[model samples]
Target: MSSKFAQNRSFKKNCTAFAAFFIMSVSYCQTSTYGQFWNEVQFNRTINAKWSTELNLGSSYSSTETSSNIFENNIQKSFRGWGHYYLSPRWKISSFVAYYDNKDVPEIGQFKSPEWRFALQAIYYFHKTGYTLSTRMRMELRHMRNGDDDYENVLRYRQQFKYLQPINSKILRKGVVYGIASDELYFKSGTKVTGLSFFDRNRLVVGAGYLFTDDIQLEFAYANEYLPRDNENQIVNAASLTLTFNNLLPNLNKKLLHKNEANTNED
Candidate 1:
């Protein structure tokens, strides 16, 4: 009876959070809003008990109400690589470098220059019986060439709160479906940011994921973005999809070697 009651409480809490996120997203549509779609593919490899790495490639597309097709315009393409070290089961630290080819501005011409970014991140996890909560703090250094062909540098800080709950089991594992939600805030500081506000933007996401196997998973989510500018604020309603592969190459190689050994024995 106690377990059943707890499950009911968890469900209610999740429903409430989802409802609030949906309402906020709807309210943002009253402003200068646009629609976007982001797709990403990630590869993860575990090097040892304390070390891991990830590579991610992603693209973004944008559309306005008058646009004929939502995906007709490609706004951004990016690649990022990360190296992680585990301090313990509950803490992790990482560093990453990223490159972005941005074509979102018509005034600047398409893909005229690119952005380079580097970040350091730390995460702390709170483990509960049925769910996990975490916070991530990241600091970023961004470099890009301005219209005058001079290099501009900016510093940004980001903080995010994330929650994960397993639907079918006590813990997240292979073949389990899970619910996830996160909210992130961004802040900017630098000489180039003199005219802009210190508060950069906010991103909120609500999503679900299905673990197909130990090596692969897929996630789909709705993301709401609010960015404040000097003249007009921008709102983005985005759909995001991510596919993750774990130890893909190593697993495939192992299977191939096993098959070859079997063939040799048969001969």
Candidate 2:
């Protein structure tokens, strides 16, 4: 038991050191910087006993420095939605589709058709610190407007960790404030891609959230993304505001019903 515990400690120490290095490099060691502000609204809700769904809407404003003009302006508009089906106690499957409209991007050009992606993912859930930690593995296929005659092919692998720590102990109450942190590292492989490093980018975000009952949530966060290029590494700084509403129509119906009941009582 002593030997096992020692090994676990060593492993955790190494992992923590690596994560710190990655985050520091991204936030401080990049060039040709940009600023991005984003807004997102998302929902995740359970359906029946074995299914769930997610809906997301988001947009962004970005500006980068270039010699041709003082600073190039860009905006991104997007939507993402997915559905989940539980297959067992610890495993599930998800299908997701997303759309993006980005301006002044090198990959998609200044003005062109929007980009689209479809993905299928498998998720495994585990318990840690009395909370759930999810490991999601996904594969995506993409379609975009490009000069190439064939579609772009890329494979990505990402690992994300999320945790919510409650500030209130009352189970019957309708509100709770929690802190959350998530980190994701990305890699890509494809036919038309060329890069010196197989590991491309890293993203880290930390923030607090407020949950009002089971219907709504609000979160604000700061995010940093590292992009590797041939000449230099680039860093994009972002601030985000997110609002999530679960079962929108159902929640509205419940409010209306309560209002009608109050009127009947008065009569």
Candidate 3:
């Protein structure tokens, strides 16, 4: 009983510290704020015991002060492909290539060209009794055209800490609901970056996810992004929704076969 009490106390203390950090990071910048809505769909496949892949398609819409609807204006569309190799159950390394098609927004004008980005990342997971904690580090190389129509090469690094807790069960599984919280910081340096501060942005996300089946999961999250520019800092409040399908091709084939069998029996 005493050991259990000590463990509970430690958990509470950690939670309190995390809350304080998240609040401070979000409040660090008070500037022009806008609203956005983001939607994403991901398809995941596992090839072998140690290898997996993912493809993602996403889009975002922005809202201005004068806009009647939050998702009134389309701002960006993106596609990404990722390959992952698991070193162990608790560690994974991944690389991805992404393309972004950005449109002109009232707050930030159109870019001279769209962006192509490549990133390498590693994630380490710590399994606890009823929850999991993860840390991810990513390095990104971005290629884009600057405002002056000059090609720019940017290097950026990101660090993220994420926590996951199951709400009604000890482990996350089919029909399970889980809560997630993550904080990420970005730092950048590039030829086009003339800002004195290398600190690019911070993103804080809090959300919940539901696993409908072994192959499908859906998540909804609220993200707070703080970006500091040379002149004016900006904050974005975004509502994000993501849907993931695992083992997409195999699952689709199985469903199709099942349907056909049912139709034949009916006939």
Q: Whole-model Cα lDDT per candidate?
A: 0.85, 0.72, 0.87
Candidate 2 Cα outliers beyond 4 Å, as residue runs: 1-30, 66-74, 88-92, 106-113, 129-132, 147-151, 170-173, 191-197
Give per-model CA RMSD.
Answer: 14.8, 12.9, 14.1
lDDT of 2 by residue, 21-96 (tens): 9998776655766677789998777787799899888887766565323134556788899998999978889999
How many clashes show up in model 3?
0
* lDDT, candidate 1, 72-190, per-residue tens: 68888999999999999999999999998877532223344578999999999999999999999999998876555666787889999999998998876799999999999999874
Which 10-residue window of candidate 1 scores lowest in summed lDDT? 104-113
Give the Å shift of residue 74 in candidate 2. 4.4
Q: Which has the higher lDDT value, candidate number 1 or candidate number 2?
A: 1
In model 1, the clashing pairs are none
Error of 1 at 210 (Å): 0.8
Candidate 1 lDDT for residue 220 = 96
Residue-level lDDT tens digits of model 3 in 1-267: 999999999999999999999987766654677899999999999999999999999999988667747688788899999999999989999999999877754333545357899999999999899999999999999886666766678888999999999998998779999999999999988355334468988999999999998789999999999888755687888999999999989988999999999999999
Worst 10 residues of 3 by lDDT: 104-113
Which regions of candidate 3 are displaced past 4 Å?
A: 1-30, 65-68, 105-108, 191-196, 259-267
TM-score of each: 0.83, 0.74, 0.83
